[model samples]
Target: MLQHQDHLALRLALIANKRATVVRLRDERRIDDTVLRRLQATLDSEEVRLSGGAAVE
Candidate 1:
């Protein structure tokens, strides 16, 4: 069972990481459509997990 504040913190971290990845992808000129799509998917899933938006892990 995760606390709400802790969960929010986790979510923030996930967002920060995703942002970093996006920056890296952009900087490396590797931000292809497929890669962006996959990153979006992963970010969405992580948000769900952080929000208790999914079934128990």
Candidate 2:
């Protein structure tokens, strides 16, 4: 269970990093609004799952 919790934390951190990178890319015009929205939604969903106490795969 502790390992599972650690995995979840790591997943959250990775998702957050990816989200930040996407935002930076979008700001620099490397990615469009559509991609940004999609990425944001994915990140939000993962966050919801973690916050809801769902186990990480």
Candidate 3:
């Protein structure tokens, strides 16, 4: 449905934003292992959501 697509799009956008933040932090040498792990966990969860074909919201 259109609403589901919109939700997917929003989730994708959020993932992109988080990825960019991670990149920015890495570039600035401000990302610690704990932060990296957290981000990785979040990305993994998002990946699962996408793979499961579930709506984000």
Candidate 4:
């Protein structure tokens, strides 16, 4: 159970990091709005999936 929690935490952290990175890239104009939106949606799905089909925010 603890290990599962640890893995979940790690995955959440990674998703968060990816989100921040994506936003940063968008702000820097390295990624276009369409790509940003698509990636963000994908990340959102991943986060919700990790949270057992519920969104965190």
Q: Considering TM-score, where higher is better, how would the candidates rank from best to worst?
A: 4, 2, 3, 1
User: Between the candidate structures 1 and 3, which one is better when assessed by lDDT?
Assistant: 3
Local lDDT at 8 for model 4:
99
lDDT of 2: 0.88
Worst 10-residue lDDT window for candidate 1 reads 48-57
User: Ten consecutive residues with minimal summed lDDT in candidate 3?
Assistant: 48-57
Off-target runs (Cα >4 Å) in candidate 4 are none
Compose the digit string of candidate 1's lDDT tens values, residues 1-57.
468798798776878788678868967888876787788777777777676776522
Q: Which regions of candidate 1 deviate over 4 angstroms?
A: 1-4, 54-57
By TM-score, the better pick of 2 and 4 is 4
lDDT of each: 0.74, 0.88, 0.78, 0.96
Steric clash pairs (candidate 1) = none
Candidate 2's C-alpha runs over 4 A off are 53-57
User: Which model, 3 or 4, shows the larger lDDT?
Assistant: 4
Clashing pairs in 2: none
Candidate 3 positional error at 5, Å: 0.9
List model 4 lDDT by residue over 1-57, tens digit each.
Answer: 999999999999999999999999999999999999999999999999999997597
Ranking by lDDT: 4, 2, 3, 1
Q: After superposition, how far is residue 39 of candidate 2 from its true place, in Å?
A: 1.0
lDDT of 2 by residue, 1-57 (tens): 999999988988998899899999999999999999998988888887887856443
RMSD of 2: 4.2
Q: lDDT score, residue 27, model 1?
A: 71
